[model samples]
Target: GGPRPLPGQEVSVKVLGALEDGGLGERDPRLIFVPGHGDVVQALELGVPTMQPGEVSFFLAAFPYAYGRPGREPDVPPEAPLLFEVTLLEVRDGPDPQSLPPAVRLRLGSQRRERGNFHFARGDFAAALRSYRLSLRALDGPATAPPGPEEEEELREQRVKCLNNCAAAELKLGRAEEALAACEAALRISPDNGRALLRRGQLLAEQGRDAEAALVLRRALELDPASKVIHTELSRLAKRQSPPS
Candidate 1:
């Protein structure tokens, strides 16, 4: 047998959750996560580490350890506890964000980003933001091995994408200041990121920082001269800046 699933390692498992009445709660035939990385519920994170590969186990996770007070809504009731059945399928060592090579980190980050996109498309902005932030965490950590140039570029591009998504989700959640910070962070990573530029400009204009918004929007326009969305935003900004009659 290989090493037991440990903190900072990636584990693949099948998991099912049920109410005490034998009613189904939640189930995933293929669930993958890294323990101690907030990838799964606290119970799984704490319990899976003690399991050997190919083992099936059950654990009772109180509300705090499972879905917490709000309890995942609709499926899991508020403050309701769940019984979890978990199968520890495989565990890989040192998929740790801090210790993974750039390539591995990129792949993990991409997976999380895709999950964020899935949630966003479903109008679950909070869930989408959580996944996007996780993707950023996976992408931002220091690499264990030195990265080649192409890998570095790939990593940077992914980071910019996640940050832009974070900004969009933040705005959707009405956290404009957080959204602005996310946009700035993306622009710092890649100054030519048009999505970041457009979002930042919109945030600035909304906050009445007209000159700053104008500058940012102009740069975004330079980057994507044919973007109808950018042009619309620019026109709206112009109307706001015009002296009220």
Candidate 2:
């Protein structure tokens, strides 16, 4: 009850109320933990720094600080205000990825990769690239001997996937050279990776290196013969190379 919780500190609290439906009828006893750096809903974020442990208070958050224009449907209405009856329970230092256990770090890396894929599916290539880079960063650690065989293999596979994803995102962003570099990195990890080979081939074709693209595409086809997209690209390249008819 002395030093107030800071912005970059993790805090646990009990929140009693909903932003919509006027508010909860019962005091919600369930505890909620806010992460460091306040990467949370704006209401809790703005209110947390003002709380002292064990102190209970109610705060009304305006729509701008709550759900905004497009609110969370079926719960919070558009431009709805939020009322929170909060009781701060505990405070602690937030997570530091470098200080986490290896298993946790690996999971975080995988989570980042999944987030990248989500962004990529939404056609947000810049966000996808950021997430892919973060995934690799999560896997980065002190340079040392290889890990145990199981973890080593897992890491190798994860890095290869991350690099391949980065290549795809870069290609979408029209960064052919960067895409090629990422594909090269992925291929270094798994030379026969069909996706990486396909990406590299596409980048080569885009750069007008038709011969190199054909060679790479052939290798990719050897790995993934059923890929119609790759087959289409090969046909396009062939037509481009054919003499005037």
Candidate 3:
């Protein structure tokens, strides 16, 4: 158990919160940010104020520090004992490193890909792909152009988006191998990426790796159980792998 938090600090936690009923409220082993830049509630504010990074706490909260009025939570009840188990992870700075402007200097190609976002969101798929490739080219180690802030952040952001779009386009174009490679690259950089997981599962199923496909699809489902497409894909895979009559 613990108390209070130092201001302007953020920590990741594995949280379990429950309402009046004995039923499980929210269960996720995934890490969550706490004192997370005012994104949480007042009760959370009260409890997390004294906690340090890597500390763990379990406690029941009272009404004043909990759902004080209506519209906060309809079912949690005024007098309910709100149980919580929390683990503080790392404290964060304003933005992630890449999001922060580079201190050293600047370059030209960086300016080019800074505008790539317009092309990407505009659905000019070919143009966006070209732009990301161009940005990556500028940053390729030595014997080429030097990189800059515009270059580095633009490359990081646009390359990720380009990879995702490539996977989608290839899938639409019936090129499963191309889609699979793009999705794999995206997943390597970001393991919990939703689109990559879905795309990879679809590609796996296309290649007749139905069992692997099912696993990927299931994970996607866990992330978003309300997704009809993922649910349908899982059903199709299950039907295909059923025992012979």
Candidate 4:
């Protein structure tokens, strides 16, 4: 057995999980995740970090740590505890987000963003926002060395996408200030990002900052001249600014 894993480090473990009745609940020969990232259940999140590579351990997880009150459908009953027999297979060095290569960041960032999208689609704005924020963290920091033109461009694009999605999720969660910040961050990455511009403009308008909203919306229209949504927003902004008319 090697050294135990630290937070942020990636771990690969083989898992054999059983329900309260000793019936099998889950079995995965190879499961990889970074601790504290919500990739695994809370019990595993707490258990795996204490294990050295090649070590095997058993953990008893309460309902809150496993599936919670609703439990897993058709198998694990509500409030049933679980017993997990896990083998720590490997531990990879955790990458510092700031020092990660652009390509690696892009890959990891894209995965988190996709996860965010899945949560968003399921109407879980809080979870979606969390995933989007994680994606943003992965994409944070510049390349330690020079990246290819394509890689740099791809990284910026992915960052913008995550920031925009973050804005969307934040808005759904009624965090207007946070949503506006996310829009601004996206615009900083890609100044001509239409989605970011539109969202920023809308948020500004909602806050009664008509002049700022108009400027941002005009730029958005220039980027997507045929966007009827932008056109509509522009019209609404004008009406608000048109005193008494």
Cα RMSD for predicted model 4: 4.2
Cα lDDT tens digits for candidate 4, 41-130: 678989999999989999999987876666677887878788999999999986687687777788888988987886677566886788
Q: Which 10 consecutive positions of candidate 3 have the poorest summed lDDT?
A: 97-106
Superposing every Cα of model 2 onto the true structure, what RMSD results?
Answer: 5.3
Whole-model lDDT values for every prediction: 0.85, 0.77, 0.60, 0.86
For 171-207, candidate 3 gives per-residue lDDT tens digits of: 5556679779988887776666778899899889989
Expressed as tens digits, the lDDT of each residue in 129-175 for candidate 2 is 98888778767664334457687678788989999899889989988
Best by lDDT: 4
Candidates' TM-scores?
0.70, 0.66, 0.44, 0.75
lDDT of 1 by residue, 93-193 (tens): 65457688787888889998987886676566887898888888878867779789998889899999999999989989999999999999999999988
- Tell me the lDDT of model 3 at 216: 88
Candidate achieving higher lDDT, 1 or 4? 4
Candidate 3 — which residues are off by over 4 angstroms? 1-128, 135-158
Ranking the candidates on lDDT from highest down gives 4, 1, 2, 3
